[model samples]
Target: MKKNQVVLFPVLLALFVFTSCNAQKNIPVFSKVVYEGNDDIYNENPLKADEFYNPILQGTYPDPAIARKGNDYYLVASSFAMVPGVPIFHSNDLVNWVQIGHVLDRKTQLKVHDTGISASIYAPDIRYNPYNDTFYMIVTQFAGGFGNMVVKTKDPREGWSDPIKLDFQGIDPAIFFDDDGKAYVVHNDAPNKGEELYQGHRVIKIWEYDLEKDQVVPGTDKIIVNGGVDLSKKPIWIEAPHIYKKDGLYYLMCAEGGTGGWHSEVIFVSDNPMGPYEPAPSNPILTQRHFPGNRENKVDWVGHADLVVGPDDKYYGVFLGIRPNDKDRVNTGRETFILPVDWSGKFPVFENGLVPMEPTLKLPEGVEYKAGEGEFFPNGNFTYSEDFNSEKLDYRWIGLRGPREDFIEITKKGLKINPFEVNIKEVKPTSTLFHRQQHKDFSFTTTLEYKPKSEKELAGITAVQSEKFNYVFGVTRKDKKHFIVLERTEKGSSKILASKEIDFKEKIQLKVEAEGDDYKFSYALNGGDFENLGGTVSGDILSTNVA
Candidate 1:
């Protein structure tokens, strides 16, 4: 147990020291990646017995929202504006995960402290009502005072409960629990269009919950699916809903053409969870947006699905997809795959033929394949080099609205941020610290050495998706000369795009090189040869459908 934690500030000379270590096997947890152009389909290592892997939860970890409380299998995602947003992974074997907490860890449970990077938290579900043992979730607080909320936890690793807003207006929220135990929430309602109609006309409400008094049961609020799943070709943003109940029949699912490149995944049915349902005769059941090689393999935005059932009973599906690296270059953002369903029809489809997202399969029968658990699961051609030497910051390092701690510090000569007199187009917390473009041709390199007391204090390395959409690449000190810049922003507006005047400095090494979402950037001044620093930089405008 190598633990050391420290955090001095003394008027901001800051000296963090958090050094904890354990999963090391020469740094191998997960690494086998291939499928950018499909090298022959690699990805494997779901603990290894007959393999398993296809994101399984890597990088951005978008939308996903699984549950299941007996043999354990939590899962949660979409922590926009990342703070202690939603992120509660634990898996007995839905491809071996591990994160344990974060359902909105305090900050007054984030009732909007100035959110932006695409607004605070949206799309989350995760339920598990064991008739009230508790563990709900239901979210969608996109922006200050937006609606739908709910949090609970008899003990989701050890925290939660405090957000119970939900008067309900819309945005991917879900709850559904029935067998007479009754509990419903299902959302995504606002999209009326009294005008010309045809921009993903949406609607799909339903509410009836009074788990004692926790709200939503006012007028039963029903509207079970309206403009989506073939409204005569006017389907977009049917949104992530989910409702499942199998056999006695209730299904519902969602995610229509809106997360880009026409995302898909329809479905409907129902003996009665609310009203007359019918759609799924294979209605957009699952889609790689019509994957016919998807422009010769760039993958394309796959639906948002959610279903779960395992403990060997099988049937899985978690969604959100991306891995474009080029044309509309998606710098590995929306992630978390894993399909394999086919519950013998009537609903759960997608077991074969989906397009770009099947890198390996098999492993699900009763789990027990413990060969090594891939050391600790972070590999997709492992190159995630951090080097802050521990002391804190590696829950896949994110930041913007939720990480300012006076601008982070991890001393030992690495991972130390600082620049915040307001810079990256200032939406606020701009000391920047990303990390979630996990693949699609990687390489991030850092090594900055900062000493900028002037030129507005710019300390390097950025790729942010907020604070006005980023690109940065740093080093400052103007007039006295010491440049190497290159900026981008675009929404809150900023420009530079390339600079260069360095003859010396405190240190410099910068590098980005993504290669599909096109990044390039490069520096290497005290060590040499990275030096490109010009062109490239698209990343399809960051993403989540152009943040």
Candidate 2:
């Protein structure tokens, strides 16, 4: 019926790591975070004028939900248990996006202080209502006993109000404001009691929303799209319901066939928003399932899209897509992609969405594409180096489950961390900070000025996808000798692949490099040559697939 949705480590020489897990009594600190993207695909097809990259916002930003207000375009994506949930982005041109802030930034707004990595916000929707002159963000908090919630703000940049918990029980909830000033909320819901015809059977439901009360009116909900385009086909996981009205007809769009290779975007039409809807002739307007498994530049699992009128006054869409490596593994997680929609016909069709997607597209007028850090959201090949000198950390550097400020602090020296007593198998937030893996071939190295006096104390670098799926590479003490180790955790099982005795020293450079599925963790002594601790290992376990 519904959906949803982690990060680490010590600093001063500064730069590093996801959900933290340890049975130690020590806390660690880190200084800076340096990430570089060197995908072979980006090298093969460099960015050229009149063309832009597919994912304007990269590195695990998935389940995209978008809305446009005049010249300002606002987009949101699923954050799961990551603190400061609901990462909100802004772009007037759509091609150049910059994250403004999180809608759930305050402690009162995000209650998943100790929830699992897979719980919290899921497939969130952001809409601007001209009638109320307010922006509404509705979502399902799968943790903290908050089933579904909505938050509003006059201006998102200034911050959002506390969430108005909606009395509903579904995920992927969205609100649509009609031209007549009436508002309606739609989301994916489970079949009533035992009516589930097959596995993954679900229904899209809509309810009359009370603007003043900021909740759904009692007993006015209706199931808009049941089991997807054709119930006879028994479509599975029909979710991410969004409603739009154009030319006196209500258009409902949703994602079907789960969030895997079978994923596709479907559309329906009705005379009313709460209706008996009809599937479009071109039911699946967007998908990559038809493409071969061995195709180059593979972008699989494409769906869960949202549409918006671009600055050019043309229809454009932002959707979730996966760019699996040659090994057919997802390490970067689901990313957000954009495409122009051809709505001049009877129904809308995603241009080139059904076909094998190209990595690049000719730029539209008034659209600007730029890579690297700064105002334009980095795409293509770029380098991001962050020094924790400012009071405010980059929005990209976030915490897992708990607030980052609780464990990490920004100071003139570097980012400091006060680790919590997190026992192995304990459900608690880690003393860590995190940045997403942006490319298949990239290097992330941070100088760690640390030494573990005891066996429990450690400080190094790591690649963490969640509490149960991750790799830890750091230094620890054993038998009065300093040693470094590489550990891997997959689906709750963990094992140490390699450990070596080493002379302790400050300013140890810890690095993790990757090429497609192969990952190698290494260390250097006081700017010495990097020593490979673990033989190149497979990174298949580092995936956040909601399959």
- State the weakest 10-residue window (summed lDDT) of model 2: 5-14
Which one is best on lDDT?
A: 2
TM-score between model 2 and native: 0.94
Give lDDT tens digits, candidate 1, residues 1-547.
Answer: 0011010000000111111222111111111111221122243322345765576765677878899888888888877666667778787878777777678867666644565555668778988888878988888886657467888888788889778787867677798889889998878776554633654477788888899888888989878887787778777567777888878989888887777677778888889988667787767767876656446445557778788887778788888777654465555577778777888866677776365555566776656533224434453455444466666665655555655454566665555554444555555554555555566565666565555544644555666666666677676666777787777767767788789888754666666666555667777776777778887767655653464
lDDT of 2 by residue, 12-126 (tens): 0113222234533343456555778799888999878789888777777888988888899999998887788989999888887889999899888888877766678888999
Provide the lDDT at 325 for model 2.
73
Cα error, residue 115 of model 2, in Å, equals 1.9
- Candidate 2 displacement at residue 45 in angstroms: 0.6
TM for candidate 1 is: 0.34
